[model samples]
Structures are given as structure tokens and as C-alpha cells.
Target: MSKIDVDSVGQTREGTFKYDWKMSALYNLGIGA
Candidate 1:
């Protein structure tokens, strides 16, 4: 959960959970794309 890094996570990683989406979104936004 808290230790998760969206960049390292993916869509199909067993128990991916929901935070994955959030982390990915944040990462994309952080890069200003």
C-alpha cells in the first residue's frame, strides 16, 4: 500500500489493488505530460 510505487506496479500483478491507478496517475501528472 504505502510502500507501493505506481511506476513499478502494473495492471496485472496478482493483487494489484486500487492505489496502483492513483500512483500511475500521479506519476504521469508529476512529469507534466
Candidate 2:
């Protein structure tokens, strides 16, 4: 939960690039699995 909050803050501060990358990576991992 804490890590998620940090990620959310990062998304806000760093913009969408890192967020999108993380989402895409998770999506691909889910698909692969």
C-alpha cells in the first residue's frame, strides 16, 4: 500500500511516462503468464 502511494506520487511528479511504462510492463507480464 505504501509503495503504491509512492508510485502514485511519482506519477504525478514525473508525469505519465514512468506510469505508462510500468502499466505496460505489468500488462505484458499478465499476458505472458
Candidate 3:
């Protein structure tokens, strides 16, 4: 079982998803998206 809290997990997941989306958009534009 994990010891992490729900809010922390949610924030981390949200941040990661945002970062990934940003990076993907940048990469796509770089390659003509």
C-alpha cells in the first residue's frame, strides 16, 4: 500500500499531464503540426 495523500497525487498527475501536453504541442509545431 502507498502512503501518499490524495491531493498530492492529484496535483502531481495534473502537473505532469499539463507538462506533457505542452511539450507535445511544441514538438508538433516544430514538426509542422
lDDT of 3 by residue, 4-29 (tens): 23334657777767766876888899
Candidate 2: tens digits of C-alpha lDDT, residues 1-33: 466657677366466567767778898998995
Tell me the spans in candidate 3 whose CA falls farther than 4 Å from its real position.
1-11
Off by over 4 Å in 1: 1-15
**Among all candidates shown, the one with the greatest TM-score:** 3
**Which residue pairs in model 2 clash with each other?**
none
Query: How well is each residue in 1-33 modelled by candidate 1, as lDDT tens digits?
Result: 445664446555644655657767898999997
TM-score of each: 0.46, 0.52, 0.62
Report the poorest 10 consecutive residues by lDDT, candidate 2: 10-19
List lDDT for all candidates, in order.
0.65, 0.70, 0.65
Worst 10 residues of 3 by lDDT: 1-10
